[model samples]
Target: MHNEPLAYRMRPRTIDEVVGQKDVIGPSTALYKMIKSGHVPSMLLYGDPGIGKTSIAHAIAGTSNLPFIALNATTSGKKDVESVVTEARMTGKVLLFLDEIHRFNKLQQDALLPHVESGSIVLIGATTENPFHDVNPAIRSRCGEIKQLKRLTQDDIIELLEKALSDEKRGLGREKIRITKEQVARIAEGTNGDARKALTMLESIVIASDEEDGEYLVDDAIIEQMIKRVGVFGDKRGSHFFNLLSALQKSVRGSDVNAAMYYLAHLLENGDLTAVTRRLLVMAYEDIGLANPAVGGHVLAACQSADRLGLPEARIPLAQAVAEMCLSEKSNSAYRAIDAATAAINKGQVGDIPAHLRDTHYAGSAELGHGGYKYPHDTPIGSFGGWADQDYLPKELKKAEFYKPVVAGEEKKFAGIYEKLKDFRKK
Candidate 1:
């Protein structure tokens, strides 16, 4: 116990002892039931650091009476994976927990699939990345996914601090420290809802204090100094990145060009460029779509350029692309159109493709009456009124215009082209 780090020494030993994450760790939840019944499945625990992902794993091991073998995805490899699986097989039942599971490459992940499928080991993978995106589909499909949310409430942190202050063997209680409610609240707030960070900070404060008569008084000023020394990097894990990206996307979606650029610069200042580029590409399809299809191409080009040029020089093109996308006329009509079409298909509303739209280049296509379809291009108005198909879009949506040009730059030209096409279709 003396050899254990203060953080480990203070680790929660049971789900009941774990603080926060009530949504996942609540008494009646599936996870809680699994721990109680000792039938826990292979799971992926995703959350920010110091938010009890690892602690929860340990607690599960302790409660379920399973052999728990921990693996760091960073340092472990195929040999390490095989060794663990071999041990688990020999032991007959084992829980193999992989921390930072997203860091595992595709090959490393593939090694676990057979063992997971065979029931020799129950895999508990923990990651800070979005599992859907970072974890390979094959590996992700085998495990139950649980999202552990970052601590966001001051009360949550305060609860943790209170526990720390009272726990004699592992916490500040051993130092005979005297902490006011105000000091506790201040320290908790400084921790930003992360219990591990709160406890560690509290321990630091106790160690740094000069004691008198075995009683050390903690103050807000000392906590503030400790926080300054720690520095706030914001959550590099969880949704902090996505939340900011969502704000940036909404700004672009709303056509607030300046606001979009500001968000882009903020990401560049503190976040990853590859992530920024990926989101920009998504915004291209989700927001711009067919209203200005070229916008997607422009975004892709910016991403390529950013990769080729890198940083300071790359930021130039990324900034230009984001500005263009924001200022461009906004439309999600095409995006909505596809989603509506897909929903209909899933519900068995799909019909045969219109004859004219079907392939006529095959050897027997024309003989089968496929080429008899009217050619819209050869018609007087570049459309054949007699050409027929079920109207996929609802009449209201078909007539319901979505993209309204902002009466500026190239967008006005786009509006003009759309007006001309609308008239041509009517004719």
Candidate 2:
């Protein structure tokens, strides 16, 4: 237990050594300025895992050069909160760094509120959940400010890995192993912007490499093995499941065939058929909608087919659908159009439905001018047997046009028809 993991040993001691999240730790930011002046206040740091929430807290505590108490909110209750408060009063100044602060119940949070407000304990709370939705409101109110941490980029991860590989006191420098830039980058890429995961992976790779004639050599085989294991050797339904699903959706929507397949493999390997099918269906409609609504039917068919077929065989149709979606011309016309109309309704820009479009079957509806409605089949207007010139929208919103089709996929033809008719209807 005394021998700490490389990630723990390599934790940044100061803000200057912290990589990435320049938005929060950059010289120009309020947190950075305060850290420099050693006048930090209560703050809540929330973001993805392994993105240095603890490192930042430690740096703040180290900078203050005051008594620092680090506690995990998962295990620490009101007793611990009161203990910290009591000690802060005696210690003059104390930095109380709480990990997984969202785990602290309302009572636990309230117990620490007074010390924070009294300037005895500068509270630094960290959690992976969104602070606004999960953190106790009272604690948040007194936290003064919140700092959002971002995922470490490939370059950032590589730099941190390099430091870990070379640092003697805090890294693997004493191991006498040599590593290439490409290997470090590969390790960084595998973990998906998680510094701790990347470092742990590097340490594993180092331990696994062979000592060839006293020279520990990490070759391509070791790297390839690590890659394959990292992609598939995790809990399928873990928190990272959403991350994989999101990656696949975005990859297909962005038309990146390679990335789409990469994430698809992760999703399929996890055997989460329902989750993948649901998100793919959403992407087909929300992203590929209007442009090619017919593809929406195809996605539905594929999902249904996969559900019946089950895994190993189910992935084939899913892969085919993913490829098609990646290659499909993209458009979000339906998404944009609906959102615009919804925004209007939300803002009170809507009016009652036009009388002509209202139902006439009710007792008084026919007598209330609903009988004047023109049947679209009886009066042919557009290419379809529909009445385009009739006032379907209420008078107040007669000129409100929500959809503007893009010239992509099947929408080009729809756009031509809409463009030709919308202008004449407004007159």
Q: Model-by-model lDDT, in order?
A: 0.76, 0.84
* Model 1 per-residue lDDT tens digits across residues 205-291: 877776788788776678899887664434443555776788899999998988998778767766488888999999998887666
Per-residue alpha-carbon lDDT of candidate 2 for residues 1-427, written as tens digits (9 for 90 to 100): 1188998888877778788888988778887897789788899998878888998888766666878899999998789888998898888878989998888888786787777888888999998777887788888988887988888999999999989887988888877787788888888888878888888888888888988766668877887787777655334654457778888998998999999999888889888899899999999999898787878999999999999999989998899889989999889998899999999999999788877777887798877777567766777765655664578778899878898798997899889888877776757
Best by lDDT: 2
Candidate 1 Cα errors over 4 Å, as ranges: 1-3, 106-111, 232-243, 251-427
For all the candidates, what are their Cα RMSDs to the real structure? 8.1, 4.1
| Model 2 spans > 4 angstroms off | 16-23, 26-30, 153-170, 173-191, 209-220, 232-254, 262-275, 310-315, 347-370, 379-383, 386-390, 405-409, 419-427
- TM-score on alpha carbons, each prediction: 0.65, 0.79
Q: Ten residues in a row with the worst lDDT in model 1?
A: 383-392
Clashes per candidate (backbone, < 3 Å)? 0, 0
For model 1, name the residue pairs that clash: none
